[model samples]
Target: MTHLPLAGRRVIELGTMVAAPFATHILSQLGAEVIKVEPPTGDTTRALVRGGPSGTFIAYNHGKKSLSIALDTPEGRDVFRRLVASADIVIHNLSPSATRKLQITADDLAAVNPRLIYCHIRGYAAGPQHDDLATNPVAEASTGVMDDHRIDGRPSRLGPSYHDQFAGAYGVIRILATLLQPAPTAEERRIEIGLYETGLHVAARDLAGVQLKMQLLGRPEKEGGGEFSMPGYGAYQVNDGRWLYLLVLTDAHWQKLATALGMPEADDPALAKLRERKKQRERVEAAVRAAVGKLGFDEAAERLRAAGVGFSEVLPLERVLAAPQARQPGKLRDLDYRGLHFEAPEFPGQAECSPGLPPPELGEHTVELLRGLGFDERACAALVEQRAVAVAREGDFAWAPVRPEASGKA
Candidate 1:
């Protein structure tokens, strides 16, 4: 709270789901004052995930204020305009067409706040394929990452919402950099991110392969083994069904790893040269990773590191959450909204990591924000009754209705 860099900054998040919400959520974690503007029904993400709505919704939205307003209404539009007029940044991830349809464009907001940094997370950049349909799978499929990571030429889903999260992180980096620069003389500065394009960039190997096929004439054929960045790198299974990763890439490390496995140097003539050993990459990797099946997880990790191989246990998501680093005061936080338990990564250490307010319940700060803008209690209440804005619960770490309109129902 006290040490956050973005303490005095103000942000208005007019976005839904992972990418845009997460980008702004990171800002809130940095102590920035973020107001999440939702439509009357709330962000659709609130109903996502298996057990019910709100799996990742809370995961990436734990420290911002929510303002549920009917953006389709004229009064709602005015409220949004007022919110943007007072913000340092505005974030949104609606489709290009949807953005125009909503009339919440950069031009619209920046007209009020000249120094506004408007960040738009689009599913695609302008081009021949830009207007094509978009979704996580389509983004990955279009970017050819699915093809690159595929085995037997069969496509597969990339881990997690890779495109969505990558786009979220990309938006964060853009905002931070824009903030560092001289504030624009004009009202708005536009920063657009395309999930389809950015996802391909994040799939570094796929980007490398484009050049590999074009620039490098002597490109080696793709093999049965994995990517060739290093020999002793990536997942290996242990006898007890545990897994670990080893990343030993130098001559000394190779020797150390081989010795740790008691895999003698004179096993075969190919062992004489690292190049020759790499030519038999599949067999070599099989020998190394397969050793885990005999050595057990702990024994293999210990022996491997002792032999100079960089090895680490691969814990499941739950186990990883309980890891020492995750429990550290400055790394993560367990946020309890009503009875719902959620976790969020703290701000980056180099940025602002001291814990800030939890995500605000819908319109939690409506009165306060309205008062700041010259509204009296009566005016604020009038606006709330009109469904233009609503108050969040009191003393909430983040906004609190859990369901912003739930209490109103009862």
Candidate 2:
């Protein structure tokens, strides 16, 4: 193992839910120190108890420290400013108005640290409709991604928070790109990524296909079949009811598949060329499906491997985790944190000496983090007493109802 790339970097994450935390998760895995700032009630995912912290929260918030503060209070805003002053990057997905009210905008932080990379992730990009309240699903629908993926005339959302996760990856790319600049004194960089834009970006391949079809045929058609519908490139159920997706895109692959399935008619004159094969798509699909469906899982896998066909079995989450590949060295580690044991993925080239940290309780690091910022013990205690900050202690609960903001506060 080698030292990770972001060993000394510091990141302050100020958003909840998936996107911002996901960006921090990637940073943490690369050895950056990520501090997550939360309100006194903690992130909403903290209360989603499914055996422990919700899987959604644990997946993104692990290895990050939590500091609970009330931004509506002047003291809390001062503390956040202090954190930004010494930070390398600050990321948040708060709404535009919320950012204005909290005074955590790019300009606000750049005044504190000129070299900081301030990144904002939102549901939509800036424009006349920039202030609309957007979520993961809404972003997907608005971008036409959902409609483009309609199944049986009904739009379907991708299983995961696809738009949010892609936006997070985009955030990481923007931050890293900013860090590559030569420094010694420079102005801050501001980047804004929208979930809707990310959704479109990720579907670039599909979008290109649609445009190409429209240009060539005067109208777009469904995917998975175009000028050539290679029957092998789809999911098929085996005799044992297991599903496997196969890929045989080239003529050579098709020949190999033909030989493996003992389907001599696949080489008939009418199906010799790709365009000809397209004309007989139903025949090809039916033939391939019948051949694959007759074989049991092991037999189908062996034949596919022998024929050099690219394929993968569809496995459930549990099976995916327990698969042989997951147990190999440098793949995963069984980590015990916060009274729970789970398999943690090992980032490529991460140092062998790296230690995993548990998700923090609400306010777990408030006092210590503030102390690191030059606050004395008395000041820390005073802030807690003033309801500007919260600190978790043994046998203590920091849970509190969020107060309605003052007329001018947010």
Candidate 3:
């Protein structure tokens, strides 16, 4: 395996669940030393996924060490500061006020390490709607992303935890950029990446369609696709008990599709010539659906490809994981960390190695980390005896109760 791109980097994560932990996950996968600082219990994501093996937590916190410290104590906060002082970057997805409450504020961390890159993942950007104590669903609805999930144009919520993922990807980009600077651009840069902003950034290009309609119709639209977006961009059902995507956009592709459908000028030219077809997308959608139902997915795909059209069969996760792509040794690796195994994605020309340590079995590294921090054997033992920290054992229970309000849904 080749060396990871960000090897030798250090990151201190003060977030939980998703968002910032996800950013650190990618960093850790790329060979950065990520230390996840959690409260004595551990992160909430350990049980987030249904019937999954701490998969949600493992997916984000892989290849990182855990520091189970109850920062509720001044001693804990001071210990955290010392750790943050030694880190090259510090990140969290806690609310702004919660960040200040945790005492890992930008000034606090920078005071300990001036060059620290501080990044915070938020729900709303700023101002009146900023940080509404949101969970994944609340953040999705607040950002108008939930509305897109519904076909009827009604405002609904997202089906998954995308808001958190959004903030996670958002933070990862800024952290990578900050690390690549010739030198530190500023002493302490507080990058605020809101969940809403991430959604907006994603939809900006699509919003142009609505904006263009407003210009042509002399009235602004409240959403994308004001009766016409494009006929080739949606899902259609197939004949052989499956669904497929038919994308025939360009003139030539449309012509090919027309021939495949056995309809004269069914191409975009025919589409362009029809005053009704130009505005009636539902009619176009129905026609395309009817055309697809006449042939099996494979037959339709072949016909479309022959005509320079694009198509793909809807595949389940199990099918995807068993495909030739997944079988490629360079594409993925089934790794075992402390008895938990999962397939992790591998990058092209980049190596992903298991850590010197396992997933840390909750607080398995607590005493060892304390010892490395210059704590003597007796002191380390004392902290454990006092329940200030914990060590994972086969029969031991590490499940800790989380304060309900502190539950980070997003």
lDDT of 3: 0.70
Taking the tens digit of each residue's C-alpha lDDT, what string does model 3 give over 147-191?
666757677765667778867877888888877777856642667
What lDDT does candidate 2 reach at residue 209? 81
Q: For every model shown, what is its TM-score relative to the native structure? A: 0.85, 0.89, 0.85
What tens digits encode model 1's per-residue C-alpha lDDT throughout 1-410?
46667889999888777788888877877778888887755677764532233657767777777777777777777877887788888888887777777778878767777778898888787677765557677788887667756756788877688788778888888888878877554532788788888877876775676568667666645433353645566787888888887776666677777788777552555655667777777777777765656887778877877776777788877788777767776667767766666676766573235444555565666677777876788878888888777565444233333465565542
Pairs of residues at least 3 apart in sequence or in different chains that clash in candidate 2:
none
Whole-model lDDT, model 1: 0.72
For each candidate in the order shown, give its overall lDDT on alpha carbons.
0.72, 0.79, 0.70
User: Judged by TM-score, which candidate is best?
Assistant: 2
Model 2: residue 180 alpha-carbon error in angstroms: 1.0
Candidate 3 residue pairs that clash: none
For model 3 the TM-score comes to 0.85
